[model samples]
Target chain A: MGLKEYAGKQIEIDDDGFVVNVSDWNEEIAKAIAAENSLTNLNAQHWQVINFMRKKFTEDGDTPSVRALGKLSGVSIKELYELFPKGPAKLAAKIAGVPKPRGCI
Target chain B: MSKEAIERVSIIISKGSLEGVYPGLIMANGARMEGIEANLFFTFFGMDAINKSHYENIKVAAVGNPGLHIPTLLGCIPGMSALITSQMNKTMAKLDIPPIPEFLEMIADSGAGIYACQATVEMFKLKKENFISQLSGIITVGEFYQMAAGGQIVFT
Candidate 1:
C-alpha cells in the first residue's frame, strides 16, 4: 500500500533510484516530456535535449536551471510552459530517463 | 523536421542599449537549450556588453528609451540613464536572472559560443584579452556569416 512495498513488486527501481518502473508511464507522459524537452520526433530532438542536459549534469554536476536550459535551446522561458505544462523537472525527468526530481513531491 | 535535419542558428547581438544586451545573451542561451548550436557575434556597441569590464556595469538610458516615462523634465536630465539602468537591474535581479556577467558565463558553460566582431574590436582598439573569457574567438563578419549561412540568423 505504501511506496516501499510497491518497489520490488509490480514496480522495479532503476539503478539511479530516480524512478521506478510503473508500467504505466503512458503515452501522454511520453508526449509531454518529449515536447517539453524540444524533441521534434522527426529526429529525436527530445532525446537530444534530454541527453545534452544529462551530459551537462555529468560534467558540471548541476541540473541546469530553467533559464539556463531555455538559453541553450533558443527557446524563451515564457515559451517553456507550452512544452512542459507540468514543468521542466517533471517533464525533463521523464525524458532524461531518470526518476522524478526528489523535491517535486 | 527532425532535430538532426535542422541547422543550428547564429544569433547576432547588435544593440548597445542596456536593455538590448540581455536579448542576445538570452536568445543564444535558449538556442542551446533546444539542442541547437548557437553562436553570438557582438559588434559595435554590442561589443561593450561582452567586454569584461563594461558588460556587467552598463546601464539603460531611462529617458531616451521611449518606453520609459519620467516626466519631460527628467528626459533632458543627464543622469537619467543611470537611474533607468539601476531600476532595470533591480527588476532583473528580483526575477532571479543573473546579471549580464553571470548570464554570459552561464551561456558559455552551456556550450554556446561567443565571438567578438574583428572589425568592431579593432575600431574600438579592443584586444582579445579585453573580452570576457567566454569568447570562442574574434572573427570577421564574413566568417560569422559563414557559420550562420544556412542556419537561422537572429539579430537582437
Candidate 2:
C-alpha cells in the first residue's frame, strides 16, 4: 500500500490506485478524489451511487458492475460516465473510497 | 507517459461456444470497469453471441476441450456438453456473474462498443435486425482493423 496525502490526511492506496483502507475515507477525501477525476460536484445522484457501492462492498466483498449499478442505483450507465468520465465504476469506487470493482468497475 | 493509458480495447470473439464467448465478454467488461473504452467484434460463429434469439443459448463445450482435461472418451459421451453447461452456469451464478443478456446490457451500459463482423454476418445470412440492439454496427474487416489500430486487440 502507498500512502497519499489529501485534505491534510493520509490515506492508503493500492498499486492500482484503489483505496486500501476504507476506514481512512471521508467526505473530504471523496471530494478531492472526485475533483482529481474531473468531477467538480457531488450531487445527490452521485452520492446515491457512492453510498450504494460502499454498502454493497461492505456486504458482498465485491462491488457491483455498471449494469447492476444502473438497475439498482437508479443511475444509468451513460449518466455514470457523465458523472465519472472514462471509467465510471473505477472512478466512482475510488471516490467512494472502496477497492476498484473487478468486472464492471 | 509510458503507454500513458489504454484508451481502448478491441476484442475479437471468433467462436460461438460459451467458453469462447465468455472470455471476450468478461474482458470487455473488465476493460470498461477500468475506465478504458472496450469494443467487442464478433466474427464467424462468434456471431451467435450477438444473435438475440441465440445468444442466451450458447452452451459450454466439454468435448475435445483440453482446457477441461476430461478424457476424450468422457467428453464424447452423450449429454456431456449439456451437463457441463449447466454446471458452468451454476458456478457463474454463484459468483454473481450475469447471464448473457445481462452481461451484454452491462457492457453496453458501461459505454463499450459492441460490433459484429460484416463478412460473418453475410456468410451466415444474417441481417442487422437479426442482432441485438446493443450492436453498434456490422463492420467490415477493414473497419475492424481501423478500429483496432494503435489500441490493444484481444482475439478470444
Candidate 3:
C-alpha cells in the first residue's frame, strides 16, 4: 500500500497508505501523496490546510475533526471537498503525516 | 490500503437543539472519516436539523438541559439561555468545531446518507423544498430500520 516513489525517493507507509514516519514527510512526499489521491497541483489553500493540521497534530497529539478543519483552516466545508474530496480530514491528515483521528468513526 | 474493520453505521438525530444536532453530525462524519459508510435518520423535532431554513439558527437548549449544569431556577433567569449559548459558542470556536450548517455540509460531502423520517415530514407538512439539498430523501421507518440492519445504530 506504499506510494513511496516521490521522484525516485522512497519512504515507508502504513497499510492504509498513510506515511508511517512523520519525519520522513517533506514537500515532495506530500505532493506525491496528494497527486495519488487525484488532488494535483497543491495550491496555497491545500498547503494551508495541511500545515495547520500538522501543527495541530504536533501540539494536541491528535488531528482535528472535519468540523474543526472547516472552522479553523480558513477553508469552508464545501471548499474542503473541492480541495481534498470525500474525506478531507482523513486525506489531509494522511498527507500531513498524522495518525487517523481518534474516536472519529 | 487494507479494508477498514467497520463498514456501516446508522445514526438517529432526534433532538433539534444545537447540542443534539452536532453529536449526530460529528459521529456520522467520524464514521466516514474511518472509511465506514454512514446513514443519518432525522425524526420528530430532529427534522428541524435538516430544514434548510431552521438548521442554520439552532441554538443550545439551555433551559431544562441537565448538561448545561444550570440549576432549573437559575436557567429561568432572563437572558440566561443566550448567555450560556454565547459562552458555548466561544469555547466551540476555540476547539474549532464548525457551526451546524458547516458540519452538515461536511457530513454530506463525506458520502454519508442523510434520510429524513417519513412520518415527520407529513406531520409537519414539510415539502421536499424545505429540506437541504443533501438528503438522500425522506424514508419510512421500515426502510431505515432495514438499512440499519447488521450495522451499529446510534440514537442522539
Candidate 4:
C-alpha cells in the first residue's frame, strides 16, 4: 500500500520463470519500456512477462534473473537481458502501459 | 527530401563492426530525425545487423579492425565477441539509445523506407523472414538507386 511496501512486492519474473511481485508501477516507466522493446502487440505472453517482471522487482528491488530467463524463454540469456535493460517488470509493465502493480510507484 | 525531389543524399553501408554499424544506423536515424526521406540498403556483411538470427548476436572483430591490435589468438576466444558487443551495446543503452534491431523496428514502425538488397539477399539465400518483419520489402539496386537519387548518401 505504501512506497516501501510497494517496492518490496514482486513485480517481475526471475530467469527461472518464478513469479516476482512488484509493489508499484507507473506510466512514464511503462511508455519507456514499450518504446525500448518495440513491442507491437501486448498479447498474453507480454502480460505474462510484464506481470512477472513487476513482481520480481517488488520482491527483490532488482531485475529478474537474467540467466534463468534465457533458459525459460529459449532466447539466449545474453540476448534476453540485453532486450530489457531496465528488466522485465519495468519493460513489460511499460509496454502494457498498466498501473504499477497493487502498491508500486 | 520529398519523394518528388531530384537531388538527394545517398549512403552505402558495407561494414559490420560495431563502429561500422554506427555509420548506417546513425545516418539513417539522423536523416529521419531531420525529416529527410532516408533509405537503408544493407548488403554483404552489413546484412548481419538485419539478419534475424544475427541481429541480437552481432559482434565486433578486433583483428584487422585497423583500430584495435588485439592478438589473433585472443580474438578467437569464445565469449570475446559477447564481451566486446556488450560493452558497445551497454554504452548505447546508457545513452537511452536502442539496439540496432529495436532502432530499426522503431523506424520501420514509423514508416521510414527500409530495404534489404536483392543481390545480397540472394547471395545469402535470405528470405523475407530472415530480416526483421517490419521491412517494406526486398528491392533491387535499380529501385534503391531510384530512391537514392534524390536524397543524401553516405557509405559506411
Candidate 5:
C-alpha cells in the first residue's frame, strides 16, 4: 500500500489502486479516481452503482459480486459493463472506495 | 509470478458431467471478473453444456467417480445418478452458484465469448437452434485458436 493524493488529500491505496481506507472517500476523490481511470463522467446512473456499492460495503463489510450487483444494484449487468467497461464489480468497488470484492461470479 | 499479466484466456470444456463442466465455467467466469478477456469452447460431449435440451439437466457421473466414495457396483442402480445430481445441485445453490443455464447467461453478459465446436455439431447432427442463445457461434478448431491467440489455453 502507498499514499497518493486525491482531492488534495493523501489517501492510502493498494497495489491495484483501490483506496485503502473507506473513510477517506469523498465525491471529489471519487471523481478524481474516476477521471484517472478514464471515466470522465459520473452521471446519475454511475452514482447509483457507486452509492449502492458503498452502502453494501458499509453494511456488509464487503462489496457485492457482479451477479449481486446486477440483481440488486438497479443496474443491469450489460449496463454495468457499459459504465465500468472491463470489470464492473471491481471497477465500481474501486471508485466507491471499497476493497475489491471476493468470489468468481 | 511472471512480470507479464494474463490479459486473456481460452477455456476448453470437453466433458459433459457436472464435475467436468463447472470447472471450465468457473474459470472462464473468474477470468472475466478479473478484467481479463475470456472464451469458452465446448467440444465433444461438452456440447451438452450448450445444448438447449441438455444444458439444464446435466448429470454427475456416479459411476467410476471415486470422489463420490460410493461402491462402483451401487452406482449402477437406477436413480443413483439423479439422486447424486440433486444433492450436488442443492449444495451448489447454497453456495450461491447459479444453475448451468443461468451461469452461462451470466458469463455471456459479462462479455465472455461462448462457442460450440463445428465438428462436434456436425457429428451430433446439431444445428444453431440446438444451442443456447448465449453461444457466440459454432466455430471450428482453427477459429477457436484465433480467438485464443495471445492468451493462455486451459482444458477442463
Candidate 6:
C-alpha cells in the first residue's frame, strides 16, 4: 500500500491503486482517479455508474461484478466497455473506492 | 517474472461435453476482464457449444468418466447423464455462473471474438442461423491461424 495525495488529502491506496479506506473517497478523488485512468471527463453517465457502484458497496459490502453492473447499473455491457475501455468493473470499482469484484466472468 | 504479458489468445474448443465447453468460455471471459484480447474457435463436436439447437442442451458425459466415482455401467443407465447435468447446472447457478447461451453473450459483449469452424459447419450442413447470435462469423482454420498470429493458441 502507498499513500497518495488526491484533492489535497493524503489517502492510502493499495497495490492496484484502489483506495485502502472507502471512507476516504470523495467526488474529487474519484475525478482524480478517473483522470489517472485516462478518463478526463466524468460525465453524467460516468457518475451514474460510479454512484451505482458506491451505493451497491455500501448496501452489499462488496462491489458488483461486470455482469451485475451491466444488468443493473443503467449501462449496457457494450457501453460499459466503451466507458471504462480495458476492464470496466475493476476500473470503475477502483475509481469508486470499492474493492474489486471477485471471481471470473 | 517475464516483462512480456500475453496480449492475445485463440482458444480451440473441440469437445462437446458440458465440461469441455465451459473452460474455454471461462478463459475467454477472464481474458477480457483483464483487458486481454481473446478469440474462441468452435470446431468438431465443440460446434455444439455455438449451435443454436444444441448449446442449451449440452450434457455431461456420464459414461466412461472416472471423476464421478460411479460405475461406468451405472452411468450407462437411462437418465443418468440428465440427472448429473441438472445437478451440475444447479451447482453452477449457485456460483453465479450463467448458462451457455448467456455466458456466450457475456463473453461476446466483453469484446472477445467468437467464431465457428467453417469445416465443421460444412460437415454438419449448418448455416449461420444454426449458431448463436454472438458468433462473429464462420471462419476457416487458415483464417483462424491468421487471426492467431502474434498471439498464443490454446486448445481446450
* Candidate 5 residue lDDT tens string, B1-156: 769989999999999999999999999988888789999999999999999999989999999999999999999999999999999999998877989999999999889999999999999999999999998999999999988999999998
Candidate maximizing DockQ: 6
- Pairs in clash, predicted candidate 6: none
Q: Which candidate is the best by TM-score?
A: 6
Chain B TM per candidate, please? Answer: 0.89, 0.93, 0.91, 0.85, 0.98, 0.97
Give the Cα error of residue B49 in candidate 4, in Å.
Answer: 1.4
Candidate 3 has a DockQ of: 0.35
State how far residue B53 of model 1 sits from its true place (Å). Answer: 2.1
Poorly placed runs, candidate 3 (over 4 Å): A1-21, A26-87, A95-105, B1-4
Off by over 4 Å in 2: A12-20, A60-68, A102-105, B1-3
Better of 4 and 6 by DockQ: 6
The lDDT values for all models are 0.66, 0.85, 0.82, 0.58, 0.93, 0.91
Q: Please write out the lDDT profile of model 4 over residues B1-156, one tens digit for every residue.
A: 656632334556676767777667766654543335567777788888788888777677756654656777776788876787788788777655667777776445333567788998898888998888877778898988788774566777
Ranking by DockQ: 6, 5, 2, 3, 1, 4
lDDT of 1 by residue, B10-47 (tens): 88887778778887777776666555677888989888
Instruction: Write candidate 1's Cα lDDT for A9-41 as tens digits.
Output: 332335433335434344444454355446536
User: TM-score for model 1?
Assistant: 0.63
Q: List the residue pairs that clash in candidate 2.
A: A87-B35, A105-B33
**CAPRI tier for the interface of model 2:** medium
True contacts kept of each: 0.00, 0.72, 0.41, 0.00, 0.72, 0.69
Q: List, residue by residue over A1-105, the lDDT tens digit for candidate 2.
A: 798886789888899777788888988998888887778899998998899999888888887777678778888877887777667777889899998776632
For candidate 2, what is the TM-score? 0.89
Better of 1 and 2 by DockQ: 2
